[model samples]
Target chain A: MNKVLITGSEAAALGAKLAKIEVLGYYPITPAFPAMERLSKYIEDGELNCKFIRVESDHSALASVLGGSLAGARSYTVTNSQGLLLMTEVVYHAAGLRQPIVMGVANRALSAPHSRFPEHGDAVSQGATGWIQLFSENNQDVLDNTIQAFRVAEELRTPVMVNYEGYLQSHTLEEVFVPDQGKVDAFLPLKRMPALDVTNPRGVNTVAGPDVYTDYKYIQNAAMEQALELIPKVAADYNREFGANSCGLIEGYMMDDAEHAIVAMGSIVGTARLLVDELRKQGKKIGLVKVKTWRPFPAQAVNQILKNVKYVTVLDKNIVFGVGGALATDIKANLYGQGSMVINGAILGLGGGKCGVKEIKEAVDHTESSENKNRSEWIGL
Target chain B: MAVKNLPIVPSGDPGALVEAANYATWRIFRPVITESAKVNPIVTLYCPDGAITVDESGAEVNYKLCKGCGICAKESEGIQMVPEYTGPKGVF
Candidate 1:
C-alpha cells in the first residue's frame, strides 16, 4: 500500500501473494528459509490463501511445485545454495516441460566450510538450466522481480529464478514500495494455464527419441532466445504500469560520457554504485554497469553499453574454479577482439568473505594502474 | 512473447506413441497368451513400461516395445514368459 521497511524475504513473500500464487512449496535452508517462513506467516495470518507444503528436501519442494504447476495453478517455491544444487534435476525438468513456476533464490556460497553469507555461486551455477535468471540489487528489486518473473514465466511457459544475495538482500531490511492489491491484480490478470485432466489422463516426460529430442531442445533454445528480447519489453511495460524504472536486463548507471565502467551483478552493483559516485565526485571518469539478467546474458546490450569505455573492471562474486569469475568470463567472451578495451576481473568476494568499499577500492586502483588485463586478481585475500 | 504464448507439447503427455522405442530388443523372454489361461486376462495393467495389452480375445504383447520383463506372465494367469532365444537358431 505504501513504502514499508521490510527484508527482501518478506518483500518477496508479499510479492508472491500479490501475484496470487495458488500453491507454495518449500523445504527450509539458511538465508532462503526466512522467505519461506514469511510466506507461511502470510498463509497462517490469512493474508494469503494457498497450498503450503513443507517437504522433506529441496528436491521434493521443486517436485511438489511442479505438481502444482501441472495441475494448472500459479505456483512458486524458495531455495538457495545447497538446496538449489539439490533441486538441479527437477529444475531441468521444469524447464523441459515448460512449466511456468517462479522461484526466489537468496543466493549463498556453495558449502564446504559451511559458511553463512552471500555469494552468486548458487544461482550462477544454474545458467544452463534454461530458467530465465534475474538478479536483484535491493528489497524492491527482489519484490518487483518476483512479480515480474511470474509474467515472464507464465507468458513464456518457462520457469524463472529471481536471485539476490543471501544475507545481504535476504535478512537486511530496506524501504520498499509495496503495491496495492487492486493495481497488482490488474497488473497480473489471472489466466487459466493448461492443466492436467484425470478424465483423459496424459503421460508426462515420455521419451522423445532421436526423432524429436533435438527438436524439443531447439524449441527450448528458441524460447530462451526469445526471452532475451521479451525481458526488456516486460520491463518497459512494468515501468509504464508501475511507474518504476528499475526493472530491466541491465542498469547502466551514469555510463554516458564515462571512460571506464565497472561491471558486476547482484547486490554488489548497489555497493559499486556508491563507489562510482564517490569516485566521480573526485573527478574520476568511472561508471557502474549493474547486470540485472544473467541467463539471457544480454551480451548485445552489454556490448553497446561498454563499447566506448577504454577500461572495464569486472567484479564477480563466484569463481569458475580453474577459470576466472563467471561474470568475468562472460564479459570477456563477449568483448574479445572487439576493441583495445582492457578488462580485468576483481575477484573481490568468494565464500562470503569480507568485501566492502575499501576492498573494492583496492580492485579499482589495480584496474586503473595495472598493465596486464589478462589475469584475475584475488583481492582482499 | 511469440514463443511464450505458443502451446508447446509438454514432455510427459500420454499417447499410443508416448515413450515409444524399439524395446523388444532388450527382452530376455517374451510374453504369450496361453489357451488354458483366463478368457479376459488382467495382465494389461501390470506392465510398468506399457508393453502389454489384454482384452476378451486375449493378451497381445507389442514386441516392438516390450522389454520381455515377464511382468504380465508373473501377474496374470493367461500370460506365459518364455526365453526368446531357446536354441542356437534364436535371435538372442
Candidate 2:
C-alpha cells in the first residue's frame, strides 16, 4: 500500500485505474470533471490501456458508456448536479440492460440560484433509477468504495454510482492509502466482462411487452434487494483482503450505550463523527450512524442498531420537498410501527453550506428535550 | 398478453423477429420497389427505418419494418409511392 496525499478526484481515478476500467465516457462538469480528467490523463500517459472519450453532454456520456458496456467492456463515467440530471435519461436504460458500469458522482446542488456547493440533491434524486449508490465519506472511502463498486456492480450485473461531495470531498486533499494494483487484481479479477458479442450475436434490450417489462424490473429489484446482503460480503471481503476497515454499508460509531442516534451520509459523516465524540465527552449519551450506501438501504441493520435508541435525528444534506430528506424518509419508514422512537429530521448543507458546529449542535440540542418529538425543519436555513 | 419466459440478461435469439411491429398498417403511401429500380443504393440508404434493402434483383421493402416514409420513392424515380389499398377501406 502506498500512502499518497491526493484529492478525492485523484483518488477516484486511482480506484478506476486499479479496477482497470476499459472505457471511460465523460463530459466536462464542475467538481466532477477533475476525476475524469485525471483518468483521461492516465489513459493518455499510457500507464493504463483504456479508451477515453470526451462526450458532448452527460446524456451522451452515459449513452456511450452504455455502448461500451454492451460491447462487453467494464465501462465507467462521472458527472455532477445538472449533468447527473441530464444523464437521467440514460440511467434507467443502462440499469434495465444490466450493464455493470460504475459512475463517480461529485454530488452538487441543482441550480436556480446556481451555486457550486455540494449537496445530495444530485445523487439522492436518482434514488429510483435502480443504480446502486455508495456515498463516500472521505478520499480513502472514494478510492476503496470505487473498487468495491465494480465487484458489486458486476456480481449483480447492475450499475453503481460512487458519490462524494462536489467541492468538499472532490477538492479536499488527504493522505489516501492506495492499495497495490496486484492486490486489487486478486480481489477483483477482470473476468472477461459479460457483454454481448457481435460474432455470437444476441439481441440485447429487445422491445418488451408490459409483462416482460415488469419481469425485467422484478429481476432488477430482486438484485437490489440482494445487494443489501451482498454489499457487506464484498466490502468485508475487500477489507479482509486489503487489511483495511472500509465500512461497507451503514456503520455504527459510539452507538452501543447511546440513546440518541445521528444519521448522516457522504462527507457530512466526518463532521457527525466528531460531534458524537464531543457530545459523549460532555457526558451526553449520543452516537452516530454513517450511512455509506444510500441505495439498497440497509434498513434491517439500521432498525437493529437504532432499535433501543430513544430518539433519532437524520441530518440530511439533501432535502425532499414537503417530506424532509430522502434519508429521513427511509429511516422514518423503517422505524415506523416498531416503537414510539421519535424521528426528527433536520436539513442542512444545501448548496455546500458549511456544516457548522452550531448548526449540528442545534440539530442535536433538542435530542434530550421532551419537545423534540418528530420535528422536521431546515437547520442551516 | 403476458410476456413469459424471457431471458433475464439482455439477450435474445439473433435475427428472431418475434412479434415485430408491422409498419404497413400505419403507412399512407407504401414504396413499391419495382424491378426497374435495380440495385439502387440510394433508395436503401435514404430509408430512415431501413425498410428497404437493394440487391441485383431489385430494391425490396420489408413492409413490416417500413414506416412508409416515401424517401425511397423521392430518392429514386423508379420506385413509386402508391396509396396502400389496405388501410380503413378494406382488409388486404
Candidate 3:
C-alpha cells in the first residue's frame, strides 16, 4: 500500500501482480521489456506465484497466453511495435475466442523504417482486431487501467490492450501510489476460469467454414460493441473503489464552451493538458479531448464532445502512409457532414521522436490561424 | 523456406535490418504460426533468450562501420536484421 516511484512499465507489472495473474507469456520488446523484466524478478523472488513463459517471439507470447486462458488460467502478456504485429493474428483470434486476457502495448511505430521510440501506429493497426484498446496518458493511469483491464476483459469476455506511448510514459519515472493490495483484491478477486468440465467437454476455437464463420465474427463484433457500453460502467465502479476515474472512452479537459480543441490519444494527452493550461491563461477558448479508449471508436462520445466546437485539430503520432493519420480518419468518419471545420489528419513524431508542449501549442496556434478548408497539418516537424 | 529476391531497403547495416524485419515479420505472423504450426521459422527466430531491435530510420545504425560479427544474432535467437536481407546492396 506504499507509494512507489516507478515507470509505467513497473506500474503495469505491479498491477498484474496485485491482480494475481496466474500466468505471464511474453517476449522482450523495447519499452515493454522493462515490464517483462520486472515480472521475471517478481517470479524469481516468489513475491507472486505465477508461471513465466519465456517465449521466443511476441507471437508466442500472445499465443501462449491464449492457450493458457483456454485452459482456464488468468493470463497476460506485454508487447510493442513489430512485436505487437507479430502477435497480430492471435490478437484477433484471442478476442474472437472470447479469452479474457489483458496485454500491455508500449505503443511504437510499425515497420518499413522501424523506430523504437513511441507512437500509436502499433495499437491503432490492431483497431479492427476487435480488442478493447485503452490509452494511458500517465504512470498512474497505466497502473489503474491495467488492473481494470483484466476485470473489463473478463466482464466482456474479450482481450484488452492497455496502450501507452513507448519511452514517453513507459521509461519516464514518476511517483505512483500503489493502491492497497486488499482494495485491489476486493475489486479483482482471484480470477476463476470458467468451469471447463470433462463431462461437458465444450469445443473451443473450433474451425468454422463460411456458414458459421460470419456468425462467429458477428458474435465477436457484438461483444466488442458491448464493451462500448460496459467499459464506462466498469470504470465508474472502479473509480468508486479506487477513487480514480479514467475518462472511460474519451476524457474532455475544459471543453465546455471552448471554441477550438485538440483531440489526441496516449501520452500526448499530457502535453495537450499543459498546452491547454497555457492557452487558458491567454483567454484562448481552446481545450483537449483525449481518447482513453480507441477500439470501439467511441463515435457517439467523440461527436457529442466536438458538437459545439468550431475548429478541431487531431494530432496523430502515427501516419497511415498513403492515407493521412489514423485518428484523423476515425474522427472524420465520426464527424462527417457536421459542418464543423474538421482537419482530416496530421502526422508527427514518427519513429519515436518526442512531441512536447511547445509542439502541441504550435499545432493549436497554426490550426487556429490557418484559413484552409478542413486540411491536416503535421506538428513538430 | 527461402525468400526469392525479397525486396529489401538499402540501409547501412543489412544484418540489423534483417534482424529487425525478422522480428517484425514474426510479430505480424505470430498468431497464425503459433496456432497452426510450431515449426515456423519465425517462431525459431523468436526462440527463448532471443531479442530483436528495429532501426527503421537507419539513423542510429552505421552499416559501413559494421564488421558483421553476428554478436547480436548469436546472443539471442530472436535477433535479426530489419529488412531480412544482408550486405550493403542486399543481393540474394
Candidate 4:
C-alpha cells in the first residue's frame, strides 16, 4: 500500500487514478474543487495520461462524462451541494442509461440560507435517482468506498454516488494508505465498453412513447434493485482482494445488547462513536449505528437491526422544513407500526453552524432522556 | 445567465428531501422537460452568511443592478451563477 497524507478530495482523486480513469470531467464547487484541481494539475504535469474536460457548468460536466463513458472510457467527477443539484438532471439520465459512471459528492446543505458546511441534504436529495448511494463515515472509508463504488457501478451497469461531508472530510487532511497501482490495476480492470457497434446504428437517449415508457422504467427500477443485491457480493470480492470489508446498510457498534441506539450518516458517526465509547465507560447502554448506504432504502436491514431496540434517535443534518428529518422520515417509513419510540432530531450543525463532539453527545443524551414518540425536534437551532 | 425573480418553496419543508428524491427518481425514467416545454429561469441570490434565495420574476431587472451579492448563483438549483469573468469572445 502506498502511504500518502491526503484530504478526502485527494483520496477520491487518487482512488480514481488507481482505478485507471481515462477521462476526468468536472466543474469546480466549494469543498469539492480541490479534487478536480489536483487532477487537473496531474494532467498538466503529465503524471497521468488522461483527458480532462473543463466544463462551463456542472450539468455539462456530468453530461460530458456520460458521453465519455458511452465511448468506452472510464470517467469520474466530483460535485457538491449546488453542484450536485445542478447536475441532477444528468445524474438521473446517467443511471437510467445504465452507464457505469462514478461520482464523489461532498455533502452540504441546499441553498436559501446557503452554507458550505457538511450536511446530508445534497447527496440524500438524489437517493431515488437509481444511483447507488454510499455514505462514508470517515476519511478512510471515503477512500475505500470510492474505489469500491466504481467496481459496483460497472458490475450493475448503474451509476454510484460516494458521499462524504463537504468541509469535514473534503478539507480535513488525514493519513491514508493508498493502494498499490499494480494491485489496483489487477483488481480493477479497464471497464469494457457496452456493445456499441458502429456497424449497427442504434439511437441513444431516444424519446420513448408511452407504450414502451412504463416497461423501460420498470427495467430501470429492476436494475437498481439488482445493484442493491450485487453490491454486497462486489464488496465481498473487494474485501478478499484488500483484506478489508466495509459493506452493509448499517454498521452497528456495541449495539448487540444496547436498549438505545443512535442512527446517523456521514462523518458525524465518527463523533457519535467516540461519544458512545465515553458513555459506555459511564455504564450507559447506548450504541451507535452508522449508515453506509442510504439508498435502495436498506429498509429490511434497518428494520431487522433496530428491531430489538426500545428507543432509537435519528440525527439528521438536513430538515424537510414542514415535516421532519429526512432520514427520520425514511426510518419511520420503513419501521411503521413497529411499536418503537423513534425520535427524529433535526440538528443544525456543520451546515448552519459548526457541530462538534460536545453537541453530538448532548443530542444523544437528550434523546435518551426524552419519551417523545413520532415527534421531530430541531437541535442547536 | 440573467437574473430573474422566482417564488421558491420554503427551505423548512421536510418533504423537500422526499420530493427532490422523487423528482430525481422520476427523471431517471422521464426527461426533465418534454418537447416544447416552457421553463422560467430563476435567479439565485447568495448572501454573505450563505443564505440563498430564489427570485423567479421580480427582483432586479438590469444587469447593472447586480450588486454581486452572489445569493442567486449560490441558491439557485441546477446552475452556478458567477460574474462573467471572461470577455464575450472567450469561452468559459
Candidate 5:
C-alpha cells in the first residue's frame, strides 16, 4: 500500500484498476468525467488491462457494460446527474439481470432548475432500483468503497453503485491509502456467472411470462436481502485483510453513552463527525452514525446502534419533494415501536448547500427539546 | 326418425384429403425452426403466425410456413434470421 494525494475521482479510478476490471464503459459527464479520464489514462498507459468503450450516451455506456458483464467479464461504469438519470433504465436492467457491474456515481442535483453542484438527489432518486448503494465520506472512502463494491456486487450478483458528492468528493484532493492490486485481487473473488459460450449454448434472461415473472422479482429481492447479511461480513473481512478499520455498514462516533444521535450519509457525515468532536468538548451528549451502506437499507445495524438513544436527528442531503426527506422516512420506518425515542428528520445541504456548524448545532439542539418530536423540517434552506 | 350416422374417418387413413386439409391447419402457421429460441423463449409467444415452438433442445422453426417476417428474432438476445437456401432449379 502507498499513500497518495488524489481526488475522489482519481481514487475511484484507482480502485477500478486495482479490482482488475476487464471492461470500463462510460460516457463523460461532469464530476464523474474526471474519473472516466483517470481510468482511460491508466488503460492508455498499459498499466491496467481493460477495454475502454466510449459510447454515445449514458444508456449505451451501461448497456455495453451490461453486455460485457453478460460475457463473464468484470465490468464497471461511471456517471453523474443527468447521465445517471439517462441510464436509469439500464441501471434497473443491470440489477434485474443480476449483472455485477459496479458504477461510480459522482452525485449531483437533477436538472430543470439546472445547477452543477453536489446533491444526493441523483443517487438517492434510484434508492429502490434493486442495486446495492454505498456512499463515501472522503476520497479514501471513495477508493475503499469502490474496491469493496466489486466484491459486494459479485457476492450478491446485483449491481452496486458507489456514490459520492459530485464537486465535494470528486474534485477535492485528499490523502488516500491505495491498497496493492494483488491484495485487492485476493480480497475480491474471481469472475463468475453469466458466462457466454459457443460449444454449449444455454439461454439466460430469456423470458418471464406471468407464470413466472413475479418469481423472478421475488428472487431478486431475496438476493437483496442476502446482501444485507453479506455487507458487514465483507466489510469485516476487508478490515481484516487490509488492516484498515474504515469498512462497515455504519460508522458510529461516541454513541456509547450519548443521549442524542445525529444520523446521515456520505460526505456530510464527515462534517457531522467534526461537529461531534466539538460538541463533546462542550459536554453535549450528541453522537453520530455515518451510514455507509444505503441499500439492503442497513436497518438492522442502524436500529442496533440507535436503539438506546432518546432523540435521533437524521440529516438528509436529498428530499422527497412533498414527502420530507428520504433518509428520514427510512429511519422512522426502522426505528418505529422500538422505544420511546423521538426521531427528527432534518433536510439539509441540498443542491450543494453547505451544512454549517450552526445548522448542525441547531438540529442537535432541537433534538434535545420535545417541541418538534417526530417532525421533519429543512435546515439552511 | 331414422338416426343419422356420422361419417367416421380413420385417424391416419384419410390420406391425400387429410394432407390437403393439413396445409390449412394451425400446425402450418406454427414455427417449426427455433434458432431464435436459443436466444429468447418469449418469441414463442409473440410469433404472430404462432409458428414458434420451444423444446429442451431450443426453438424449432417451421420454415415451410415461416414467412421470414423477422418478428421471432426481435428483441432477442443473440437470435438472428439467416437466409434460407431453396436449392438448385426446382427440386422440391
Candidate 6:
C-alpha cells in the first residue's frame, strides 16, 4: 500500500469505493460536496462500478439510499449542516427500519444567521434519532471510520453516521494510508437484509399500532445498545487486518496519572493532543480524552477513565442554546454518582470559530483558578 | 380466496384499548384513479403496512392488508380516503 496526501473528502470517496458499495446517493452541500464529486468521478472513470444518483434534495438522497439498502444494495450517502437537518425525517426512518445505510457527515453548525465552517451541532442535534454516531479527529480517522462504519452498521442492523469537522478535515490535506481494496472487501462482504425481493417478499418499516409500537421501538433500542460493545470489536478486527490504529470508540492521550484532562471530539482532539504534549514538557498533569464514538455515549469508557481524575474539562463545538454543550451534558450525567470529581463544560468554535491553543490554555487556567467547580465557559467569545 | 374470520384485536384487553377494533371493520374507501387522470396512483415509500402494491397495470391498495393509517390517501395526490361502504349494510 502507498501513502498518499489527500483531502478528507477524497479519502472518504476512496474509502467508499474500496468498500464496494453498490449504490451511492447524495445531494451536494458545502464542505460535503467534495466527497460526492470524487465519488462521481470514480463512477465515470470506470475506477468504480456503482449506481450513482444525484438526487434533488437531501431528503431524497437519504430516502433513495434507504430504499436502495432495503433492495439488498450496499448503500452510502453524505450531507452537512442544513442539509442534514432537512434529511432528519428519513434519518429516523432509516434507523427505525434498520436499513444500515452508512452516511458521511461533514459536521457543520446549523444556521439562523448562516455561517459555514466546522461545528458538531449538525450531528449532535440528531442524537435522539437512534443512529450510531462516530466522530473523527483528522483526515485519516475520517476515512478509516467511514470504511469501518459499513461493517458496524451492517453487523448491528442499524444506520451509522461518520462525522468529521467541515473544512478542517473535509478540505485540509493530510497524508493517509490507502488500504487495499481486497482487504476491505474481505472485511466487509456483500451482506444485505432479507427484504425487497419479489419472489421472497418481506415487509419492512411496517406500521405498528399502539399495541405494538412500543415493542417495535424497544427492539430498535436493543440493537442500539449492541454498539457499545460491537464498535470496539470491529475496530480491533480492522486494526488486526490493516495494522492501522486509527479506529476506536475513545482514545486517551497522556491520561495516566493526570489530575485534570480535556475531553472533546472531532478535529479538536488533534489540537488537544498537541496541547497535552506541550503541557507535559512543563511538568503539568493535564491529559486529553478524545471521544471517537458519541452515539452510544461511551459511558463505560468515560466513567472508567475520568473517575480517578480530579477535574475534567469537556470542550464542545456544539451548544444546546440555554442548556450548554451537548457532550458536556452527557459527561455530567455519566459522572453524576462517581464521587467528588469536578467537570467543566466549555463551548467553543461555534459557526466555525477557531478553537486555538491559546484559548485552550486559557480555559485550563480559568479552571485552575476559578472557585466554581462546575462552570460552563465560552472560549474565544 | 377464503377469507379468514378472526378478531383483529386481542380478546383480553381493556374496553378502551379494544376500541381499536372499531378501526378493523372501518373500511377505507379505496381511491379509484380514472383513466383520464394521466397520473400514476402508486404509493412509492410511505405505505405503513406495505398495503399499496404497484404492477404493470397500475397501483392497487389491498384494504385488508392496509393498516388504515391513511398515509397513502393523505400524502398521495391521486388517492383519497372514502368510507368503506356508502350503503347501510357496511355498518361496523
lDDT against the true structure, per candidate, is 0.84, 0.85, 0.77, 0.74, 0.82, 0.82
Q: Which runs of model 2 end up more than 4 angstroms from their true locations?
A: A193-195, A200-202, A370-372, B1-5, B10-23, B35-40, B86-92
Tell me the spans in candidate 5 whose CA falls farther than 4 Å from its real position. B1-92
lDDT agreement of model 4 with the native:
0.74
DockQ of each: 0.33, 0.50, 0.01, 0.02, 0.03, 0.08
- Candidate 4: where are CA atoms >4 Å away? A350-352, B1-92
Candidate 4's DockQ is 0.02
In terms of docking quality, how is candidate 3 classified? incorrect
Please give the TM-score for the first chain of candidate 3. Answer: 0.95
> TM-scores across all candidates?
0.88, 0.94, 0.78, 0.78, 0.81, 0.84
Residue-wise lDDT of candidate 5 within A136-159, one digit each (tens)? 999988998998899989887889
TM-score chain B for all models.
0.60, 0.66, 0.22, 0.25, 0.47, 0.50
Worst 10-residue lDDT window for candidate 2 chain B reads B14-23
Q: In model 6, how large is the Cα lDDT of residue A160?
A: 92
Let me know the DockQ for model 1. 0.33
Q: Compute the interface RMSD for candidate 1.
A: 4.3
Q: Better model by lDDT, 1 or 2?
A: 2
RMSD of each: 3.8, 2.5, 15.1, 15.6, 12.0, 7.0
Residue-by-residue lDDT tens digits, candidate 2, A1-381? 879999999989899999999989988999998998899889888988888877788999999999998877888888999999999989988988888899999999998789788999999889999999999989999999999999999898889999988879899999999899999998887765656766787777777667577877888898899999999999999888888788877899999998999998988888888888888999999899999998988889999999899888888898777778899889988888888787888899899776866788788875555465555767766
Question: What TM-score quantifies how close candidate 3 is to the native fold?
Answer: 0.78
Instruction: Give lDDT tens digits, candidate 6, residues A25-69.
Output: 889899899999999988999988899988899999999998888
- Error (Å) of candidate 4 at residue A339 is 3.8
Q: Quote model 1's TM-score.
A: 0.88
Ranked by TM-score, the better of candidates 3 and 6 is 6
**CA lDDT for candidate 3:** 0.77
Please give the RMSD of candidate 1 to the true structure: 3.8
Estimate the lDDT of model 1: 0.84
The i-RMS of candidate 6 is 13.1
